[model samples]
Target: MVLVSYILAPTLAFCNSYGTGLTDWNLSSTYGKIGLFIIASLVGSDGGVMAGLAACGVMMSIVSTAADLMQDFKIGYLTLSSAKSMFVSQLMGTAMGCVIAPLTFWLFWTAFEVGSPDSPYKAPYAVIYREMAILGIEGFLELPKHCLALYCGFFVGALLVNLLRDVTPKKISQFIPIPMVMAVPFYIGAYFTIDMFVGTVILFIWERINRKDAEDYAGAIASGLICGDGIWTIPSAILLIFRINPPICMYFGPSASS
Candidate 1:
């Protein structure tokens, strides 16, 4: 029902910002937790967490597939491509991700001490989901077991966000700190936030300088950047296999690349 609601009314997905603020993470994660709650209620506690995890997986897959379908439809409209061919291409890419994802994970898991202080990618979202599952099983009183201080912080933050949003004008609301932006450091740490800040600064400057051109080309530019980053990862992984670290990493201490 939640999935259908989002499909029919896309704005409903964004409405989560006003609630528990889980939508800040992403639409899929937010809805997955909803599914988790429902599944837990039906299955009872013993297997509820596992059931919730399964529900999260299914919800994410469905939401993501729907999102991808929409994007393909847009591209098909522009290029006049056949819908059948687009569907086949999407399936082929999905199959490739199934194969490549595990091997890529294995490469990183074997190469670095995952979840350690030194690791580059800490898998922060995985930790958040795990904690959410625990919370679903145990409820509010058990908050301290996970991290009571963090939970309290989130609660206070959400309250402030709601209050601020209420008083702020709609025209200026875009300038207000989004609940998701404030919640970032709690989930993924400050480094990712720093990266985001850099990107935001760049966007701010671009929009200020040439608002029209930025509006016109931003979509194409962003798409190219995403694809370029993904393409670069292949070579980066190959370099790792050959024990060749990045040039910048060589300047740092021995453990920097790890």
Candidate 2:
């Protein structure tokens, strides 16, 4: 962690100097993706493979974000945090992002294989990249539907959260800042849990009950891990040393939260 911190300090400074914000290239954004796939295909089979693998990792990373956010929403429902503060937190990391979509693909694609041992569930990113390089983007496009499912589920959950928040009592609603975070798990839990139907119904019912207390809870949960998909994690770490209830100014404090 020490070595990592030392290296990233200068690296991040350079990015900010270049106007890169983490949210600038959030994974959900389609611009980077559309162009990336197009260019990767142009690079031929080899490049296409790399793009596909990265795409897979990107999918996982995104789903994880939704899951974590949903979890936080439930917590927020109980805590009653301020909405604006939570929103600020999400944006904090988003302000320092830049897109290196192709390179990101390469790194994550390679890493997937490096960590795993052989198993029937082998969609190793490296092999995926190599295949893309050889066959073409068409093959990459047909890779699988699993990744999309996760993202779709998360989005649907987000929708549910919004709907519940609208009808909830004003006082109770204060607890859950962002209801989507809780709703995400409710959706995901549908497929993974044995008592999925029951769990989901319970979650929805309880979510309504505590809706008033959920102020920016989802955003807080979202901020806690990647908030802005790592846009905040790094900066948050930098300023985390100041663990006070209220803010204290330091001239050089964590890039002024951008």
Candidate 3:
């Protein structure tokens, strides 16, 4: 399977990146994951589930990497920046993320066994992936009873979306609730969703108050905030690694007395 994937990976990456660059849409990463899942399932016949999972991981990594590079190039084109510089920066960022991500995870896992009953971080995405893999390999019976309602809701939501687009005025349609926004809350827990809500509210308020310069500076401000958030993680991880307690840390769990 590795040999076959190696032979075909370049073509796969090219197709994924080409579509992403042309459309500026993010379907490539998703479609690549699906393609890898299918290929892995086929490979499972000979090498079992682990082989298939490994293949999917490899393909997903390749496809996502290619897609990221293409998207960065697209951004560079729009911004009149050098594609070579963007590529170099992306490579550096990716390398650092590969190293730091695991270490950060280890820090968190040591601090709190995430997804455990006592842990605040429930890892909803990991649970979804595990469920998806189980359903894919073990058939629909492995799915929960609520999945039936979910399937029905999906079709109902699709129909409603079409109805909304048809009946609502174009200007009003733009303000209508997006299905993705509505659906995401079901996938993620409240803590993350609260952040999303807060960010959306902040953006809305910013647009209302700074209508004149919003278009010019809003993106830069948001970008700065995002970069700051990410940059702060380095110091956070260092503090965790060195066992340096902060001045204040929120203890969301049981009290020490309890």
* Reference-based lDDT, each prediction: 0.63, 0.46, 0.65
Query: Comparing 2 and 3 by TM-score, which wins?
Result: 3
lDDT by residue (62-111, candidate 1, tens digit) is 55655565567556755679999998988898899889988998999999
Judge candidate 2 at residue 27 and give its lDDT: 26
Clashing pairs in 3: none
lDDT of 3 at 157: 88
After superposition, the stretches of candidate 3 with alpha carbons farther than 4 Å from their true spots are 1-51, 70-79, 82-135, 155-168, 227-258
lDDT by residue (1-258, candidate 2, tens digit) is: 223223333433332222212121122222224333544555555555565445434443343344334333445555777656655654453343234555675777766654356744365755644454454466455557676577678668867776777789988776654643333345334322233344446446656878654432533443343333353445557677775343566465566685
TM for every model, in the order presented, reads 0.48, 0.30, 0.49
Query: Is candidate 1 or 2 superior in lDDT?
Result: 1
- State the lDDT at 112 in candidate 2: 68
Model 3 over residues 1-258: C-alpha lDDT tens digits? 676666667777786787555433344445444544555456543443454455556666777788889878866865789988998999898899899988998999899879976679987755664444444454345557888689789969867985897799998897776554454456444443554465568788888998768766655565455435443557779999999987887667657755
TM-score of 3: 0.49
Per-residue error for 144 in candidate 1, Å, reads 3.2
